[model samples]
Target: MTRRIEQGVERGSRITIFVDGAPVAAFAGETLATALIASGRIAFRRDGRAALRGLFCNMGTCSECFVQTAVPGRAPRRLRACLTPVADGMAIETGAGPDG
Candidate 1:
């Protein structure tokens, strides 16, 4: 299970983001990877070879944390979970499926 840093630090406003139809609690200004990791979802996607991929180079140089996201009326798009900030109502899918 993924765990959050217990620094006893105050966080920004909390928001809900959907991951594979399940709701995950996230704080504003935090990256999707951070939220996922805190929520015990370490694997962001699976490669063509079926290898699980998660955060690697967090500075966007590597695309290991890519995830598919979709909003109402808009086509699904891919973004790096480590670089993309979490937004309220964001829908994400993680895996080597048609959506991701």
Candidate 2:
């Protein structure tokens, strides 16, 4: 099931992004956190105790939505998925990050 409400919201152009080497469909203008949650992902990262973490604030304040992302020419780095927009061909790795 998808978390996105398709009733009133107009969908953007379809784009594909890789999450943990798996393909996930998303809209062009949506945030990585949006796409990930819409794709039925529950855990964004693992805490020090191996507990799962997911989107909390949905904003940039809490760092619960952290993930590692890498583009064509960019090195993999930890980023707040809620603040980063999804891009075509963007690769994401969940259950990871500096905190995990």
Candidate 3:
């Protein structure tokens, strides 16, 4: 099971988001990477070589956590999962690039 920090810090309100068409529980003010990690989902994407990639820098410097996201009436765009905040009704698709 994935474990989160338990230093008694209060988290924001809980919300639901979709990852690869699956519902995931997340809290407001939490980054997409954090929410995915908390939900035991570490593999955010796969490279062209078929290598699974996930959070690395935890910041926006690295592109390891890139994921394709789509919102209602909007075209899909690629963004770093670690830098994007988790929002209600957000839909994310992982491993969207060319398959190996």
TM-score of each: 0.84, 0.84, 0.85
For candidate 3, write residues 1-100 as lDDT tens digits: 6477769879888799998888998889999989888887778888889788889999899899998886768888988988999898888988644331
Q: Which stretch of 10 consecutive residues in model 1 shows the poorest summed lDDT?
A: 91-100
Q: Each candidate's lDDT (Cα)?
A: 0.85, 0.86, 0.84
Off by over 4 Å in 3: 96-100
Error of model 1, residue 28, in angstroms: 0.2
Candidate 2 contains a number of clashing pairs equal to: 0
lDDT of 2 by residue, 1-100 (tens): 6677868888789999998888999999999998988887868987789788999998899998899875668887889999999999889889554443
Give the worst 10-residue stretch by lDDT in candidate 3: 91-100
Clashes of each: 0, 0, 0
Alpha-carbon runs more than 4 Å astray in model 1? 6-8, 96-100
Q: Write down the worst ten-residue block by lDDT for model 2.
A: 91-100
Model 1 TM-score (2 dp): 0.84
Residues 10-99, candidate 1: write the lDDT tens digits. Answer: 878989999988899999999998998898777888889888888888889899899988677787788999889999998988864543
For residue 29, model 1's alpha carbon misses the true position, in angstroms, by: 0.8
